[model samples]
Target: MRGHRPALRTPRVRTRGAAIAAFVALAPLIPSAAAAVGAQEITVKLPYDCALPPGPQRVAVRVAATFPDRVAAGEAIRPTGVTTTVELPAGAVSDLTALKATTVVPETGLALDVAQRGAKAQALWRGTGPARPVAVPAEGSLTLRTTGDAPAVTAVVNGDLTLTATDLGVDLALGTADGAPATPASLSLTCTLAKDADGHGLLATVPVGPSATPAPSGSPSPSDSAAPGSGRPTAPASPTAPGTPKGPTTPATPTERAKGRTGHAPKVGDARAGSSADRPPAPPCVKKNPTDKSLNAYITGYANVRKLSGASLIPVSCVQIEQGDPEIAFPPDGSIHLLQKSDAYLDYQGRKQTPPFKSTFLTFGFAPTTATMVLEQAGPMTVASDVLLVFPDNIAETYVRAPLVLRVLDVEVNGTRLDVGPSCRTQTPLSSPEPDPATYPGPHLVMLGKGQLINGTDATGYVLTSGGPLTGEVTIPAFTGCGAGGEDLDRLLTASISGPGNYVKQIQGQTCAVGVEVPTEGQCTEDRQPYVVPKPER
Candidate 1:
């Protein structure tokens, strides 16, 4: 009886009242006026402070993220794009920026944009390659920063490093703030905090047309030498120190010191003792500096001089001389073609071999003629003895013993001779068609051809520039003790430097393709004039 007392009379609800109740319940789901007040995503913080290193040192930056709000179940945190700005020091190049980053992140992707020197800045996405380049405004002392609050975002940026150009005396930084700003995320700003090395600005790297044919092997060369294979200019400081003297020294600026040399002669203190007395009298001429624009233009002229090829002792071709006092012609082809009316002495014959000379694998391929003694070698030969032969003033086949390694500079035939040392390699050209570009993508960048000799004895010739073309030839006469026919097995000098991007042709017979497998030559057969292709390790 007590429970039914309150609801004795039931009242009917009006339709208008029901409608109003529904409107009130759905109001929260609709956009509220205050909804815009709260932050929709995490905030990005930039480092406001910056520090510059004393001298030239390279600096790099990386930006990563940490989790706070969860975007999805499996994905917790990731990287947003990183933006770096560099400020050049006063009097230094303004607003120059470079970047170094990798696309390695979890659950999220990132992009990197750099602005330097008021030039067009580059944007590289983590997963993708370089994007369209953009231009940035000039800047003053400021901190460069990055933010990643895209629509599909979740976490906040953990931290970021400031990048400063070590090579330049500039500083870089990021901005740090406690609260967030609701501005557009486009980081299109520039800064000036570092200065490029004085006088040591980057030089231009242009590819010349083609290589000229090498001069004939064993022939007397005129006084003038030829240009390098890449047609890059040579550095004229004297062939080497003791051999000759340096040209007039103009005031050298600090920038010149930082540029360094391209395997040029060492500085005064670092010069080596004269290795061999038999070393030909130092060349009378000086090498032109490779960095000189005028000299480089002159050298590139040889690209169309002549084409070298074929198997003949005396190459029938010759390239015209461009400059120098006593104009001379050189063997346009790489091979030494000695065309004689009658047979002549082929091997060292009158010359005495040197010591450490236990046994040498003499590799020779001679086509005996009525007057020509043409013996061709795959590369240079390594003899174990130290025996020297002297041409007699009277009439004696005299001999002498000297240094172990012989730097065959000039080749003498009668009284005239040709330059055949390291310098000569550049002067000579390939008889074969410029190496197939398909085999080596950037043909001009191969610094070492098949028969380049480096550092006197080491067969490992180095690639001159990081990505420059091959310069000289590469040959290895001695591989430990594995003799011709693979006998007397010694240390193995594998072809690590010979690979794709370099030259390695495919021929049927035992051709000397960079990294090809071939049967060993018979005992007594050696690779004469062998060029050593240098690898990064050895």
Candidate 2:
């Protein structure tokens, strides 16, 4: 956001040589005599009716003087200068443009010069030559025009203006430019606003209130009521009155003049008020997976194995698996569960572990017991789950056990299953002498037989490891999904699964294949049945 600071311009004053000198020499004597000439306060009305946009808008302002009155000294009163201070509501104004002042009082030899600071302007006047004295025109007016960016200019009555956000204060001082006060018997300052080319007169033609009644032509002037010791008259309790205490006193300092004065500005019906309570509560946040009925979803992988006994392990063929019935649930407490049914076959060399050989059930669940889930909003969801290789009771010889168990950890699931922990390594082949169970977790099945696989968590197996279930933790990448009833729900989904206890191949000593190895990498797609859960109520 850029700020617009008022540009400083040097004051332009035009004065004839002898007249300025004479006026300065008599400046001291003029104040006392001017005080007795009667105080003349005029109502300045500024009618504003402009159609503005909701935000900041620019409008042109025009201030003009009209109808000067005759003074008691048998000479017509001439206003050489007019100084006005306008304060806009806080935060309601931005910048001003095209600010200028000009005189309309015909050839009593008056010229105009303008100076302005933030919200304040002074129009100075001087005689054209030493021979001409400043004189006010009975019919002409002095006009000041400037463009300002304000919220809305409601109205300016007396010296107070109203805006939609706050009030604006305006102060007017008229007399000689050199600080000499010349009292006028009667005068009228007409302030008009030109909005969108339509002129709206702000000055009130009719008498305002009791305090603002018109003074008769021959009536004693308002300045006649001066206090005993002070040479200035008491200002009336009207909006047009200056904000300072009334009495003869020094001119206000620059700091004092810049301060905003408080006054009442009438409110208009253009602004509407609203409260936040009126808004309806928002729907819960949730996401759902897409459904694909085809059971062709498969994950495939290939890995190179090395036997620690100095033999190069077999180069495994690519393995493909079928996946089905995928469902993810997110509860209010921020826990998530992912369940899917999958099946794959194990083949090494000439022997094949056919269907019903090992039942495979992939269950990924995430429950954060200590730290918070990073996938709560829209990031990758990482959770802990175990990779379980279960061999069901089947036609294969009673049951075969290997010498070591395999554990997969640090599984990351984004859009795809990324790294699957460190590769399983082995020192002895399946044919080698079995290591003690205490020394090594007797080999857990790293591959599952085809027909033994079930669709979901119903697959049966035995515990083969000591620490816990094969399920560790796995992360699922963030995905877009539909909420309950097809509402748009976006969230990072994650889960942790307690590993299915390792599958015990045999109780006594049945023999399966020795030195068998499985690939460590694969990709698959699943015809997953998607399910959606409604967001829980607060």
Candidate 3:
């Protein structure tokens, strides 16, 4: 409604024919004042005005046209067709309901009623042109009526006029020039009524020109500021505090980096895999607090990563940066296998909730000595098998191979060596992992503080595995691929040995000796035998 074009005057051609013929031809154009009043052509709009509600609603057609000067009641003026339309504001609710209109010209005045419900509301009319469909867009105007009891509604011809009737069954009393009899106009309209779309009576009423009253000298002019009483002392400006940033410092320009504002870049971070100083402090690896801004940002970051990754697996990675006192131990092979509660939950478009914490433990391995992790269960989707890591240099990267998962084997602040996929079943899928620039794009790693792994597209939430369960789900950034229920979370554990014993003894917190197998060519098939770590004596 804010951007709608001004109401322009278009010529309405006159024609004479039966009611059926007139309806057929006039259906394209609005009926003229001559056709309705039996006088010279007069201009008016049918259903002269309407009441539109704040939300979506629909209304019907009001035929309008012009006539010669003034005409008495019972005189019929015939011409053209009837036009239909609606009024509304921008970003406001639209009338999506179905709408239809019917009109009748009684001996004295014209009457029209429009019905719109659901999506069937027809807000505009079309003329029957053989070649092309006539485009008669909806017209809406604004009218400033006097507020309070017995509100006076006048069409502001000077500015665009929009009449809104607040209530139904409102009385419309019309008077012609001096001593002319008043027209008793009564209109009852039903549909959705917005405060702005409300109409007082007719739609095609001629606007009354501005009154010729003289201006009062005491009235304030538009350009003049309000006058204040003299002798009032102006208040002194407050003194600035020491060591504080200057007030109203110029806003940061696009060319300037945001100073004092710090956080991890979207997806990239230090390439350092595990080190107290190099890695960002773990997120306390705690459950997300709903109102926590950092938590929200973290969740959003995770969601963004998931969107880019296009994987349905849950995300699990060590928190690298910390706002206050950030520190993490680097286990042998640079992997720290710590438990993590998810930050939020995600689901397929309103379908089913995927399991949560669907992934647990990651074993960091190097290409020379480590590189093989065990897979206890393959999980649900093959695509869910992947892990993203931020290197010491602040570069975010990913590794994917189903059934051969990674685990946090150890943590050492210095000289830490992380191991991955030692007992991992290769032949699953293997390649010296390389970051897809398009997916893992980022600024220089040395400059970034923290980063996030792109988790899969499942509902994400955090729940304490060791401590009391703190539960909360992250909000999906976009509405797509999310609804009430869907893939909630993903969890997995890769053992370091063969048989269920390797998997069973570990999760129970028992001391179990497990064997590790070295993967060949970054791919481990069943042919590889693992070194067994004997189970501890009970």
Candidate 4:
């Protein structure tokens, strides 16, 4: 049903004798695997009857826009690269000439209907005049080519974004041959679709699918982030999948929706507040505008502190200053060594929640007490990847180090809140690699990741653009700087959470496209969004 549709939908046009003719006419427009590559281009031309100052004149309105055939639900529907052309009758020039004008400037507005999930809204697509004012031609009709950014839409449910072009309005300003404003007050004209008795003025339809979320561990989605891990360019946008589509859509998680950050596109280089997204070691300076092939990264990892027997979910985002060259390898062995040029970003040290735990310290005797903690990013996370050749052995390994410090908010002795003080924190930052017992105050947090094929992404490694699971072990250093009024609870804090051999795991979603590029959609509908972080590790 997602492919070619049954002919019954258009019985009136497809008679038995005309079957071959129809096939011939539609052969070039068939949707194929190739068409599913990126954003597709569409043009709609229609005739309109305008209410001109000199009376009604029939004209043509042609609209060109770029759109993806399919989009995940709750994702931004950016109808980019749009331009509109309106043909004007000679009478338009005559009216302007009557005002002693030699040239005319115009602005246009196109009103169309957008329907999704049984709801319809009229959208006014604006248009601006060409760079130069139109020179008044002494003869027949003059044409005005204009462009504008269509107001974007966000689809929350599965369905088709059906657009129907209907009414249009144009405002004109006249100028004399001397270049002075002849009619600065401006003259306006309106028009309506002449032959849209049915749905002939329908522009285009984009199907919206569901949110993309990976299954835990062994259970993976059909395609997590169909991104090519090797950083290959995504294919060109293809035609809409042909069929009597039954409201294209996928479901969104309720919990994600509750957070208010799920189901929308995050801005390029957008990092979560207080997560080192805007720290010193920033990733490669982002260009004013990134090219189509460029990509960014975001990840969430589960960390289990062995000393505390508690876990925390860490959210991180990154950008690539330089793409890892596939043709070249670091240490030219049979396997390719991909030196990825990307860096992890977390901004200000965001205070995050951690599980509550009970600890037994010698000083506290046999008393059972629980400490509630908040974990914060110490600094920017530095990340890179290890890639193997796609030919013989297929493996994309990821590596990154996170600097972090934990602070205890409150401690309850048998349900009694203990004044651990605001400054109760570890003396040194947590380290992810194997720690040296002799070195008591060193800080670090690192993760080792394994790549998963983002189906249809054509990529084979855990490049910045691709995503997968990363795991690691860490050592929580000893506690220091505790207590208020010199109550010094350093020993209590260290006994409760400071130690080593902690475990961590995380899944990074595929990078989303920014600039003039198509989105890198894997199986995740909303999985690629850095804004919608997953639930914490329980």
Report the number of the highest-TM-score candidate.
4
**Distance from true position, residue 420, model 1, in Å?**
28
CA shift of 369, model 2, Å: 73
Q: So what's the TM-score on candidate 1?
A: 0.16
* Model 4 regions more than 4 Å off: 1-298, 308-310, 313-327, 330-332, 348-372, 390-393, 434-442, 452-464, 516-518, 521-538
* TM-score for predicted model 3 compared with the true structure: 0.15
How many clashes (backbone atoms < 3 Å, residues ≥3 apart in a chain or on different chains) does model 3 have?
143
lDDT of 1 at 445: 20
For residues 94-212, what per-residue lDDT tens digits would candidate 2 score against the true structure?
11111111111111111121110111111112111112222333333223322211110111112111011111211111234343332321111111233422212221111111233
* Count of backbone collisions within predicted model 4: 28
Error of 1 at 365 (Å): 38
Candidate 2 residue 520 Cα shift, in angstroms, is: 99
- Per-residue lDDT tens digits for candidate 1, residues 87-190, read 22421112122111111011112222211111111111211111221222243322223332321111111111111121111111111132211111111111
- Candidates ranked by lDDT, best first? 4, 2, 3, 1
Model 2 segments beyond 4 Å from truth? Answer: 1-39, 47-69, 72-83, 89-538
Point out the higher-scoring one by lDDT: 1 or 3.
3
Error of model 1, residue 336, in angstroms: 24
- In angstroms, what RMSD does candidate 3 have relative to the true structure? 30.5
| Model 1 residue 430 lDDT score | 22
Q: Candidate 4: deviation at residue 245, Å?
A: 18
Task: Give candidate 3's whole-model lDDT.
Answer: 0.19
Per-residue lDDT for 47-69 in model 4, tens only?
A: 89876654577888888888776
- Scored by lDDT, the top model is 4
lDDT of 3 by residue, 395-461 (tens): 1211211122222222221123432222313222111122344542321110011122222321111
- In order, the Cα lDDT scores of the candidates are 0.18, 0.20, 0.19, 0.49
